[model samples]
Target: MDSVNSLLEGFGTAMSPLNLLWAAVGVLLGTAIGVLPGIGPAMAVALLLPVTYGLDPTGAFIMFAGIYYGGMFGGSTTSILLNTPGESAAVVAAIEGNPMARSGRGSQALAAAAIGHFTGGVVGTIALVALAPAVAALAVDIGAPDYFVIMLLAFIAVTSVLGSSRVRGFASLLIGLTIGLVGLDQMTGQQRLTFGSLQLSDGIDVVIVAVGLFAIGEALWVAAHLRRSSQKAIPVGRPWLGRGELRRSWKPWLRGPAIGFPFGAIPAGGAEIPTFLSYVTEKRLSKHPDEFGKGAIEGVAGPESAASASAAGTVGTMLTLGLPTTATAAVMLAAFQQYGIQPGPLLFERETELVWGLIASLFIGMVLLLVLNLPLAPVWAKLLRIPRPYLYAGILFFAAVGAYAIGGEAIDLVVLLVIGLIGLVMRRYGLPVLPAVIGVILGPSAELQLRRALQLSDGSLTGLVNTPFSITVYALIALILCWPLVRKLPLPARWRQRAGTSAR
Candidate 1:
């Protein structure tokens, strides 16, 4: 009954004409930006942060939610049509989606992708509505120490699961923490890391880092690998899948969300694992198993749906836990902090309307993007064919503009350029940049929380292990952090021999 009333209240807020209109505009803009390569939802929101300065918070938030859903919708398009995934979540979709396109049923592949996106997106929204309340209800008892513990758990899990090399991941995280510490000390009337530069005194802007690392870095990477090879424009057949195709795709759609939502709710490593799992499941369950790799529709459908579902699942964690498993989620969390809206267990109680409205808008936005994309995907693909030089140069220009706008200092632009170069170098050497970004975002907060936790427990390591739940949580963190090392234990000759012998 209480859930019903909360939902009713949510509908009242979501149904407002002003909110509805903003939601529509946000979906459109998100789709438009998502269609462009290297300009995903994180980049879109970060770039638009300055513009939200004058708008009402509710309206701006609704728009931000639309952009989030819209980017997921738009990401599948590039993966299937151009074989260029706009987001990491879209990477799995590109595996089979691109192959299906090359199989001369590009239209069928695209329709499957669109329908799958819609199906999974709707399911994701439902899951959000169903789960967020329960989570929030339980969170009502949580205090500052609980939040601190939760944040510590999140930081450990995120860094541990991000890269193959834990050392590298921690290194990246420390770099981010260092950057995050650049601003003036909050408790003191002094500065910590500002080397007397005026812009440094204000600390580096999150928007600058987001845009430069994601948008600018990607542009530079593409420019370095720009190919002049002619891509024979593949004809897109009828965009609508037949009833038979839809029937076959339904299971994958359902199964995908089941796989995806949980993944998004976990650490960054969690999402990638499921894509491989989904592919394996689809391959085994496919009625037309022979058609896999030869354009089996399930191959394209399952991963596409799962990836989007995973993307949606991150929202619950971000909103209720104030933790982000993915780089994009981290950026969104930063955006929320920028607006002075700290999302966590207390968020729903304090800002129920905003939370529910945002969830409701996702449902609306998914439908809107489906309608907009179904008949007009070909138009969206034109964004991919833009000359690389032009696209990259424009990105550099925007990075400069966004940097200057945020800090109004010439030094911010210089720092942005330097970071972009650092990003380029990191990408070149295969160092994951997301950890550094996450570290920068969470490092100081994590430190403060740790200090508080120590203080609360009277500095006894044993005192910190008071609760069974938290004790288990720490054990879990240790296992995850040491997983790479644990898996390398040397007593498994049978396992190693079996794998090597099987390969022979």
Candidate 2:
């Protein structure tokens, strides 16, 4: 009941006229930028962070919610019309959505995607509302050892599970940790990696890192590949779905959320998996399975809904645990840090209104996206025709501006360029960037927790596994690290029984 009252109060705050306008502006800009190829929600948020420096925290976050939801919807528009996914999360949607466009059913595909996003987002927000407080409550009892273990699990999951090569991922994480080591040590007030430079004492800002890696690096890479790509926008009519079509979509909408939220809640960096799973499930259960490759509506509906729901779940996880599982969530965490706010169990107890209001804005953003995206998809599709040189050049411009805006230090610009070059190399080598981002953000916290645990145990290593939770988390991390070898092992003969009726 207390949660209910707090939520209502949140609705009251979010419904204010100023906040609503911010939401509208965010969704509009997000959709416009998101429609362009190679731009996802994380890059969009990183590019916009500089402009939000002057706004109050509540308003800034409310607008972020709108942008987040709008980006998800806008990705669908591009995927269906141009056969180009804005990010990995939208890859499954392009498998069928583009085919539907070629078959002249683009309108139905757009309608299913829009409505499915609405359903999953709404349901996921409700789950967050009901579950976040409980999770925060439970988190209050965790000790330093448990926190360290959890961070280890996050490191293992991200580095080992995300990209094609664990070696590249671990190498990227080490680079981030090295960057993180440049600042003054929190305990001894001693410099570790700073080479006697005054600017190095304050540590490299996350905003600079994000903008350099995501915006500048992506722009450079896209420019290299730009000339070889040709894309045409498909026309979308009124996105009208008949009652029969709506009936076919409703169940997948519900199921997609169910499949997506848990994956997002866990700090495993598996955001792309749920969409693929949802797509496969929909195809197998769909009555018209043959229609899948030819542009089935369920194919569009299920995966898109799963992607949105997964995003919502990520919001809840970040709010409750201060753990960011995706790149976008990592940027949001950096935004929280910019305001001198630390997100964790204490956050709910201290900043009740701010947290709840952000949650409420998510609900509002979903409704607004449904209204805007369904009709305006064709309009958004026009963004794909933007010339590659202009689009990428603008990205570079913003990246420089964003890096320069942080503390007005000329050294920051140099660091940005250096990191941008590294980012390009990583992208060329297919190294996943999320683990490195997470490592930089969490390394300091992990070190703090480790020291506390050691102090409590008089430097005894056994203290690290003093609790069952810590042990379980460590076990999970070990399993994640060793799973590749396990997969290579052949099954025993007794366990390899064929699936067939008994001959008796």
Candidate 3:
């Protein structure tokens, strides 16, 4: 009941004409990027952060949320229209969306993504309202020791699941921590990694680092592989689903959220796991098994819905405990700090209006996104018709502006270039960039906690496992980190009983 009152106050602020306008603009920009290929919500938001520096905090956040959801919508558009998925999660949608497009059911594919996003948004927000507070309540029980343990678990969770490999993820996190530790130590006045550089004493800003990694790096990659090609997007024929289409889609829509929400709630969870799981679930359980891979509408409907819903689930874990489940979420968390806002534990109490307003605005944003995206999708797809040189040039320009805007310092630009080169090399080797970003952001925080935990135990290793809960969590982390290796090992004879691909 108290929560409801607070949320109503949030609505009061969110619906104000000024804030409302920001929300609309965010939706517009988000949709624009969503339609463009090789650009996504994460990069778009990072690029646009500089432009928002002078804006009011409330309006800035409203716009940022729009860009986030907008990117999700846009990625699906590229996947459906060109079989080139602009979003990682959209890969699942492409499996079915591309097939639908090939069969002249392009309109149906778009409709499914739109409807799925709307439903997923609503479901995720409701879950946010219900679950975020519960997590915070649990967090209140924590002592410094518990915090140290939780942070360790969070780091392990992110490294094990967020990246392709645990070692690389840890290395990325160490780099971030190293960067984070450069300035003055809060407890002691000592400078650990500054090497006597004056600028290093102030510490590197997360926003600057985020811009370099996601936007700068992505722009560089685009420039290197830019290609121009196009067929104008097929216009939506029916625009709205027919009775049969809805009947076929109902189960997938329902089932998708169930699968997606759980995956997104896990530590360092991303949309890929749930969408793939949902796709497989649908194919294996669908009554229309023969229809799959042959324009089964369910294929397009299930994964798209799951991907969006799971994205929402990431909000709960991220907001309450400072855990970032994906690259985009990590950037958004950085955005919160840029505004002097902290998202974990005390967030609901410290800035109730901002938190709940962001929640309610998601509902508003979802409606606007659906209306705006459905009609304008074809125009958005025509972005493929854009010249490659101009497109990448614009990307580079925005990347530069975004990098400079936050720091107003030139050396930051130099760092941006170096990181961009690193990003290009990582991309070439199929190494995931997200874990690196996570590692960088969480590394120092984890380090401080590790030191604290060791001090609590008087540097005794056995003291680390004093708590059964802490021991259990560490074991879980060990198992998860070992998952890839486990998959490659031979299966026991008793377990090799059945064989069939899960239709998804």
Candidate with best TM-score: 2
The 10-residue segment with the lowest total lDDT in model 3: 494-503
In model 3, which regions exceed 4 Å deviation?
228-238, 452-472, 484-504
Provide the TM-score for each candidate, comma-separated. Answer: 0.90, 0.94, 0.90
Which stretches in model 2 have alpha-carbon errors above 4 Å?
Answer: 488-504
Residue-level lDDT tens digits of model 1 in 1-504: 666677677777877999899888888877777767767777777667665566777788788878877777777777777676676556666667777788777787888887887887889778877887888777767654566667667767766665556676676666777888887876564787777876678878777777777767777887888777835445566577888988889899889989888988887553455554676689899888887655678877887777667767888888887888777678778778778888888898898888877777777778887898888888877766777677778777877787788757787788888778877876777677777777777766766766666777789765556655567677877787677676853322332342233222
Better of 1 and 2 by TM-score: 2
- The window of 10 residues in a row where model 2 has the poorest summed lDDT is 495-504
Give stretches of model 1 more than 4 Å off: 230-233, 269-271, 486-504
Residue 11, candidate 2: Cα error in Å is: 0.8
Model 1, global lDDT:
0.74
Q: Estimate the lDDT of model 3.
A: 0.74
Task: Tell me how candidate 2 scores on lDDT.
Answer: 0.82
> Per-residue CA lDDT of candidate 3, range 152-230, in tens?
7766776666544567777666656666676888667788788898877877777677777776777777777665444
